[model samples]
Target chain A: MPAVSMPIAMSELIVRLQQESPIPMDAELRCTGGQLLALVGPSGSGKTTLLRALAGLVQPRHGYISCSGETWFDSAAGHYLPARKRRVGYVPQHFALFPHLDVLHNVMSGMLHRAPETRVAAAHDLLERVNLAGLESRKPGQLSGGQQQRVAVARALAREPQVLLLDEPFSAVDHATRERLYGELAMLKQSLSMPLVMVTHDLREAMLLADEMCVLHRGRTLQTDKPLELVARPVSADVARLVGIRNIYHGEIAGHAPEHECTQLRFGSIVLKTPYRPELVPGSRVQWVIPSDGVVFHRRDRPSHTERENQLQGIVDTVHKLGEITRLAVRMEDEDRSLLWLDVPSHLARRNEIAEGVTATVSLTVAAIHIIDSTS
Target chain B: MDWQALRLSLLLAVATTVLLLPVGVFAGRWMAESNFRGKILLEAAIATPLVLPPTVIGYYLLVGMGAHSPVGVWFTELFGRSLVFSFSGLLIASVLVNLPFAIQPAQRAFESIPQDVRDAAQCCGMTFWRSLWAIDLPLAWPGVLTGLTLSFAHTLGEFGVVLMVGGAIPGETKTVSIAIYDQVQSLNFEGAGSMSLLLLLISLGLLVFANVLGRYAGRLHAYRNV
Candidate 1:
């Protein structure tokens, strides 16, 4: 029998799936009610599979999935709850609305658990809540991608579920629609009482909406923390790469400068200063990263204080404009071939006359430089 | 025109269509949904009627329904009669001979249904029967109708299986096709030619209906893709 009662003690979703067969995963995740937890990973990293497992759409060969104290799946005791029985609202990537049904019936279809008379009114109310009130009579195919995504969310909400799972729900929409949907999702998230787990490959998307993020790699959950921390302090070089840190490079501990409240590192052909780590022995090889936020573009017109430490002269390798910001890839003037990535406001690049094949100086914030374990 | 033969042929076609409705639906759906290792082999087996000669099917049906066969003996003990050369036997032969027409288009229709739509139906808390009725049937009804029309057209014109299983017994097994053959043999060229032309027009009409339904099913699948 499927577990129906929500335990009072089980207020949050806790999942642990570990096995080698069928979709292999060693993922464990937690999210309190009303919080949005983003499962961030690259493609084929088992992010969607993990979300499906949570929603009871995919069963792990071995695992325990519990939400609000109900044991939805426990492989040891051989307990399994099928997808429908679980109070989960899953919004698939494509927003698989019933094509034969109009938008109103599509939302009402998921309201089967509610009273018959209340369902229609409830569906109307949900459609209204999702800002789709006028489109209640339209079919899914007639709606725009953003509108379709809204209907999918409304349908999921009609279930009155304990947990909501969205699999890259806004990916199909245009960029402008995505920007609008992001704001709408942020608003909707504030009103949701259930925990929402969203799977996304874009860390920027996760950072924009998720309260906490769980970084996944090769089917294993690597780190779970606030999105900013995951970006600034990844636990290993492998995760640093996964989080899209492009400045990770080989370095060695030069020596500790206790009086300066920092430590020195031997970067390729140069010495750089970072936050003090007295525990590290000098001459030990290590991997380090500087957060993109820490990379400051130096200009002749303006003076900044922290630019004094780790000032490096590099040739701008490439410059690509992205709306208001210009993404710059700078190859440092050293034996190292790796390029450092920086995103500055578009006007900053134009004002500084920065472009490809031009020389530039940048400051790697001492406090933002992080050392990571070499082992995965 | 042998009106009794025509009437018997209409009865056989209608019976074949009605009887094969559920069989075609379930089998076609199974073929569409199943991914077992032997699925391809099973599909080929089900398609044998399309490629095999009607006489081969008729001969096998004759052998399997003879008194010495277990089915024949069991059927006789149950129904107090032999299995061959009767309207019931002809109906059975029609259904078997029309399997390909009744199943292939329907299977293609069911297969065209996006799997994610089925997943969404299940996720909506709809049971398997509910989804099949409310979702799968709605999406696949056009293809199913195509199968029925194709089967009806094919059943209206079947001759070899009818000849082998149900011999020319007027009002019992002698269908319009066999009646036309008998008319030609007796040198009644006018009667035979008129009946053949009428059958041709009816089959043409049904084929056109089936083609329209098939295209409608294709459009439904295309809409889902969009």
Candidate 2:
């Protein structure tokens, strides 16, 4: 039989949007199968609301959700299954560990009713897997925050769920601990073979863990695609800004020169080349996305011939050291009044001694110049 | 000194706390989670018994339990019993009067729990019963304990309600508090002094015990929320 004939049924999720404004608004959507997807948005963006709705905790005015093809909620059908029957594992941001139960008891609680005696040993195995082996007998109050979160993760997995929802799981942990947990989670996802949905505000985390990233704004999914693609080629300026693209330029397409195989953008006296197909006639509004890392710093006179894509004369207005990288805020003379932030590696920054008030030539490769779909 | 009275008092107190445990837990959960209109009014009403004179409650109970009343007739037919001047009547009165002692502390404890904890439990697909058993009950036990101790001790010291309903029936409804009052009324100095001392000591011991339990429970909640 073909793989399609023996296809494993995927979870069907749907949500309807309708709410008074200010924060995440109402929206409707349906997703199938257990896809490792990341819901990335800023604070108050409604990522948490979507997670809760899927979990059956927040019942919208109207929506339907089916897990693994099992109909759990249908407002039209008047079918509603409580969270317990939904059988989804939800790991909250705080990882609510039972205070009265020890680590072993906490993990075992998931399987308590179905398999009573197996819980103790299963808990031990899970604890050991999460790197809390000997600490199973210890109460949650005795454990550190990271350890408690690990215990919470172990508990959620004990149920052997098909779908797992994580809400900002690493937000509370230190950088080193978060890295370690992320590695653990990746390993767990491989073995679980389940759709793991995560809500995150951190761009790095979304990029690292998400198979597909959904960018939500005011409760609507603005863009959904592979993680790297969202950053390298955003759907719009809002998405580019959300993904931390610090350089955005507004200009008009001056002309399309077939000989150059590029479109010429006119901003004041400077002309920049964009690799995007010239889709409009001359004098159409357009925006350019240049990531901070794409902007290279060099003395106005010293430059490479290979970097002949987009060059602009700008003064280094400010410079600040940020860990392993140096951040430079450059002011370009454009009618749009946009500021460009360029990130230089610490070693390169030190060698070049880039500082404020230094006149520098900002060069961007045509490949790095991403054309954003204009709102208008 | 009056063994029958002493036994009656102890019986009423223990019975009241035992009866109110489930009620206290239910009320605590309700008040903690529910956000309805008149919620504060309901809470104030529940705590009214604690502040109002016990005699006023006793007077209402006496009127309601009168042989001609509807409640009295229902009780008569259903249980083949009349409540006035009976030991069971005192037990019922004590449980009703001291309910707030148990419920108020339990509610406060349940309220102290973070919403994140409840949301976490809900997210795990744990049903209402399972969440209550596995999370809410355990987390709120310290508060329950506080309510239990207070209700029991308060019930033991009740004189007004027991006097009005149970009366001074020897070997049946003559609780220690009532007996002490009777002794003082009759000028039985020795009997009054001895019974009063015992009641005072027992109540003092219980208060001390509750203080220790409260401290230990505080530590437990702190430990778990970590």
lDDT of each: 0.87, 0.79
TM-score against native, each model: 0.94, 0.90
In order, the B-chain TM-scores come to: 0.98, 0.94
Tell me the tens digit of each residue's lDDT in model 2 across A95-155. 8777777888788877744567677778788888888999978887788778988888888
In Å, residue A67's CA in model 1 sits off its true spot by 0.7
| lDDT tens readout by residue for model 1, A108-131 | 999989999998899999998988
Lowest-sum lDDT 10-residue window in model 1 chain A: A1-10
Q: How many clashes in each structure?
A: 0, 5
| 10 residues in a row with least lDDT, candidate 2 chain B | B119-128
| TM-score of candidate 2 chain B vs. the reference | 0.94
- DockQ scores for all the models shown? 0.73, 0.57
